[model samples]
Target: MGSIEQPEPTVKIPIIDVSGYLAGDPKATAACAAELREACENQGFLQVIGHSVSEATQKKFLDAISRFFALPTEEKEKLSQSNSPCYRGYEKIGGQKLDELDTNATTDQKEGFSIRPERPLGKFLAGPNQWPEESVVPGFKEAYMEYFWAVHSLSKAMFQLMALSLGLDRTYFDAFAADPDGICLCRAHHYPPTPPDAAGRTRGVGAHTDFGALTLLLQDTVGGLEVLHKRTGTWHSVLPVEGAYVCNIGDLMQRWTNNRYRSTMHRVISPLSHTDRYSCAFFNDGALDMMIEALPGCVPEGEKPAYEPLKVEKHIVERYVQSYGAGGTYIEQRA
Candidate 1:
């Protein structure tokens, strides 16, 4: 019986094919919506297949990411993350604040580039990215911009699912849409080879929850992301499947559901002795002025309030600055 590996304490984390719903078929849309409810309550994470983000667009992002990260340290360092009003840029290894989460614990060992949707110079999360000039990286600006638009569209679909899962009409959130600009951002990561963790250490990104709404993850080759099943206290490897985007709920979902949903802790752990990893996350941010209050249908009665009503933009930016060591100055422009 002990050989069962303790069941790994996993939450099923449903797999849904979105092609039907996206094709304007009512039957498929209903089926997809039902599955999203199951996933949100059980794991708050799932594998999205049949999503229309073509493999070609995925290849473009992958190719551009490979080329961008392959640049020399001198060239990449020019766009280091410290230059942004919101700290979005190239971040060196072990950079980034996970906030009050084990600050003295070992820092994650990796480097990445952060890109966000376009907005006025003063907007915190929607500002332009610090792309490598074409001269330096050939077609980086062109590629990254194209990649951004593609993921942005997918993020919108995920948002609609969130609204429906909360027992609200699919268009409920449309009223709170960000100014002509939302705060969706993307991060392209590169993790170099690392030795195995001793007994209790983690690699890549640390054990923490995402601070926004849904996260659409794209990975290439190697894998290291792990999700901690709160019910079982066991960690499970987040397996990779080709042609699918891995989706996970964030703190926003947890709050909206009054804690019925899980925004569980996830971290990156090293593989064997030698391996490299590449990953990207399209962070789905709600509108700047949206009120992040609990959903009536989620908690019912006799359930304790899990989170206070918060302005999503404020909570997200506040957490981002704190997690990395900044003194809470990422002032997001209100819509």
Candidate 2:
């Protein structure tokens, strides 16, 4: 007789309140770390509340992004990503194809702008960002940078929790992440309402796994994000909760943990509502030259590491080349 198939368990993404950790309470921090371990191992995703990023600040940054996206196509095109060697600046709707492995994949129906830490002109992915004139989008740069630092701080805190979860010293990951060469890409995405006829065909962003260490996402209430359940082969919607940032482990983290933590596949479906959707994703990867290898605590006795050590930046550059095709020339040249 054939073996029976058991149904997959219904999994809800965990919501963790990080206020105590932010306040430096040891017990609360450890408790949250335990919860985070379970969430990362089982679903690779969770929502973080009480992360200390102000609501007013979030609103200001999002408002500025909305205004920037509302500019004339010509003006927006002036900062096109194609013009940037290091992959910073504006990307128009239908400019990116996220699901490179899917033959039927279409260009994503979202517009976006990307920025990274400003550094000397010779550094790859570390040069100055292309911005709209102050007259074009008042307060855009200021608001965005403020939010960037807030999120960066939160990411560092999260790393501490992750270390505790893995039975390592709380600062185990800090050295790799502390360098100026650490690559943190901040992206603002705008998904316009899909027409009825196009709703069935297009995606705001195609199904893909993030390629970095961690992703912290702030999404507006127009919910369309979906995550794939590996065990069930089913898709689940991720509805946005007010004032919470959705957080997820990414490929690099999973590699570092020897797959003890997951990096699940996720995507953004086109919104059915007439209202637009806005989201900001901050991807925190460790330093460019940092070697990603399975942590000792994550490997069981007599088990081998699942992956070879990889240079963080090289891995990211390769993924970008696959995803962006011709637009990935800068990294390709470097390779």
Candidate 3:
């Protein structure tokens, strides 16, 4: 009897300043919700910084997303994503396989544009947004809706500091994000520059695990972004931090925190820098019929509520029909 080794995961990626919970300051918002509840229960990723959303408005929304990915691939395939319907638009370069929900994953070379919620909710991946010709990217729709409403108001102040780090009531996710209807989305990625004989089976995004409930990313400093230290299975590097805003915790906020927060498993490792790697995620995922459950102060008495309720838009359209299938009908087929 002799074979045991697990023990490495410790790269320490927490930067959470949150400017005293955006200056409401109740003792710096309880020390920023105890450092965002120990960085969302250890490495579900974090790195927010005062979050005032200005580095010249995230460099004018990454310079209008590098002028809409330097147009002309037939004018960005005339806003592709197979002419939307709810897939939003533009996706070109290796047009997403995002490891098509993993089958030994590997297809993501990256190139995106997605967008949702331009108010008119009605549900099911909301709708409307495929813009590109504000006279051909001159202020690309007002610098991407002013950095998407300033990171959707810092993801509703990070869901009230993730409900005051779970002791609840920091407006406990404000009635599941009631607003002009929430189910936020807003991608922008680009990636490009990874072709030296395709760099070992490509990947500017692959690992996966972020089906919603907070994402916020912003990147652009040409990093690569990795993270998956599940107890030393190794893969860390999430470096870039100028005006920080990496934040993570997804999988519907780790099933409403019953597993006590953690949705890790990130990736995007192609950039060794030939100069090309913008980013802009957003996500959020609330109120698509919001039900989620599990948060009775994150169940503990007799321990038994790991996750079941779930309904946020049918678990985000059944993880987008198990990661992009159903061609383009993310739920609405019932016959």
Which residue pairs show backbone clashes in model 2? none
Return the top candidate by TM-score: 2
Which regions of candidate 1 are displaced past 4 Å?
Answer: 1-12, 99-104, 176-179, 195-202, 301-305, 326-335
Which has the higher lDDT value, candidate number 1 or candidate number 2?
2
Put down candidate 3 lDDT per residue, 1-335, tens digits, no spaces: 11112223337688888887798979988888888898888778888888878889889888888888988789988888667666677876654454533565545667888786675535576767788878888988788888888888888888898888888888878766546677678889988886665434247777778888788898877777878776666877777888698988888888888878978888776744467888888887777777887877678788789777878877777777655552222334221
The C-alpha lDDT values of all candidates are 0.74, 0.83, 0.76
Candidate that beats the other on TM-score, 1 or 3, i.e. the better one:
1
TM-score of 1: 0.88
Residue 236 of model 1, lDDT score: 84
The window of 10 residues in a row where model 3 has the poorest summed lDDT is: 1-10
Pairs with backbone N, CA or C atoms under 3 Å apart (clashes), candidate 1:
97-323, 97-324, 99-323
State the TM-score for model 3: 0.32
lDDT of 1 by residue, 208-301 (tens): 8998877899987576777777667787877777868889988887887788777878777665546667888888776776888877777667
> Which candidate achieves the best lDDT against the true structure?
2
TM-score of 2: 0.93
Name the better of 2 and 3 by TM-score. 2
